[model samples]
Target: MIHPILDDNAADALVALLAVREAGGVPLVGDSRWSTQYWSAVSSHAKAECVGGDKAWASFSSGSSGAPRVILRSASSWQVSFAAVTDLLALTADDVVYVPAPLASSLTLFSVAHSRSVGASILLPSRPSSSAEHLTRATVVHTTPQSLRAIVEVIEGGAPHSMRVALVGGDHLDHALRRRCAALGIRVIGYYGAAELSFVAVDDDGLGLRPFPGVQTRIVGGELWARSAYLASGYLEDGGGPFRVDGEGWGTVGDRAENDASGRLMLRGRIDGAILTSSATVIPDEVEAALRSIDGIDDAAVFGLPNERTGALVAALVQFSPGSSRPSTARLREQAAARLPLTHIPRRWFWTEDMPRTSTGKAARSQIRLCALEKKARRLD
Candidate 1:
């Protein structure tokens, strides 16, 4: 039996999850706000593919690179990590965790389970926009940077809050966001992982990402691979996907990374997202990170467009900070050149007030590229 989560009622969702666990039925958590056609396709596919008594539950991938898929995993896979993450976060029954993200998100679902495992209460808002009322009651927040930024904006507007620590994931945490959290007196703990790979590495302080507890990570051919019991079993219908598992029980989602001087994992980006232009490869995450570090730039999404001379040309969709005017192309180029290589510099540019984001709050580069091709986005160059 596949249970679909259509509402945002935290109590109902938790009760359903517990019932499914007791009944030994697979739960397919879904968002009702999704298109009916999309939900129908997913539910039908899940019903046909989701078999096996051991399959505990299913959730969608981040889909930042492409369309999301349904992933199935056992209960122990997540139950084991609950203890690890709970201990890492120093969570206790006295804590009240707030998660504003939708239930379809694995990150939010995991946080709910983790909180319940430690006997901690949860404060899940009916709508993400209605989270301000519960903010003052929450001791810990499990959120993405996008959601956390909104919380910061709310706090800046004179709303009272009692959040002490936040477990931020799903996207990169910039220094500006960190500063805002610091001003609010909230300790930000950023982590790097995937839906399929679970917890691979974690950044405790401002230091860097080390291997997550019970997980061993290694760089293999520029991709980070890990061996951990927290990994999901596999996708429901996997023909071609980034997820890979080796004979030695090591798995990787094709994320490129290297070890820094401190022996911590330094993520470059996903290998599949590398852009091929003029016989050179450009990692969009590296370029976007560079662009975001520049003053007056709020966020960025980098991609490649088809070019006649070069195989493809590097392009970028930039979101400027509030109160900052869009800079000239030459000025933008000059700033990019200081931080990026010639091939990495974007030849095409576009600007939007708000950058497109995946459901999990990741920069939707593919969607940005599609908008550029369709002439829906305002092109600057």
Candidate 2:
């Protein structure tokens, strides 16, 4: 089977995907938005053996943890969950599912597959629009939090929202965003998942995520491990980084989480995304969450900046809404100090008009750090 190089063309990509699936060929999909380094990783996975005797989909990791790599997902891995996705979204032939992310991305790719399996019409990625007319027949919207944020504002203060279900993924759904979506009558459900692990847990009630049905999750060494039918095949150039499968067939993606008393999974952050300072190991997501909680700040990214003393310094890059007055760094440090340990409080601060994010809305940490460092990010102390 000839593998197709999918790019910005959705119709061509869809046709190519259909051809590959019909021919039982695992189409290797790479995001055109990715750096050449990302493509190199996908090239490495082209050598991996297609484990099952069925059609499969080869995708690259989101690199939110660290460096991106290729992952081979069997057709059954998605096909087995088709009905679940359909039922979860309450999709029908009359329903039109809208996903504006690129077809190359796993979120949009799986969404494209899900809509087709359920016989639902799809609105593929195109010129960005917030017009209510475009969302007229949109019953279900599968998108990232970044994209959804842009969309909800378009629904007006009390618009007759046509969208019913909002299937969000690719990043953590903030608390305020969840409430805002609910206020608009859009039931937003976010899934915590990875390319290597299709669907691990889902948060529907704005509390926390629970292991998906038929998915068994356990906290191992402060990291989340799972055994599910939808798990992906082994990586091609897996240097044994975070992709590990125990002898019992449980695989973890290096995500750290704690289990609450009621057994709901509380995500701390990724084990790979932590910053080791002189006094404490700071999780950027935790600090970023705190930053987002602050007034006037719209989005934030926290990363470790190289420092001669602490080996690394906690740095924050922030984005605020237009017309909002910028908060002083001293004020920020004071606010963060109340909620975080001294070590967790940012030692430096940078501001960007918008966050550095990938096509799927996940933070591009490396790019973000580069952007801030280029600006000579201000130091707090």
What is the TM-score of each predicted model, taking all chains together? 0.95, 0.90
Residue 174 miss distance in model 2 (angstroms): 2.7
**Against the hidden true structure, what lDDT does model 1 obtain?**
0.85
lDDT by residue for model 1 (207-270), tens: 8889988999999899999999999988888597889999999999999999999898899999
Name the regions of candidate 1 deviating beyond 4 angstroms.
7-18
Give the winner by lDDT. Answer: 1
Go through the candidates in order and give each one's C-alpha lDDT.
Answer: 0.85, 0.78
The residue pairs found clashing in candidate 1 are none
Best by TM-score: 1
Q: What 10-residue stretch in candidate 2 is worst by lDDT?
A: 43-52
Model 2 misplaced regions, further than 4 Å? 1-4, 35-55, 127-131, 157-161, 238-241, 373-381
State the lDDT of candidate 2 residue by residue for 101-121, as single tens digits: 777678877887888887888
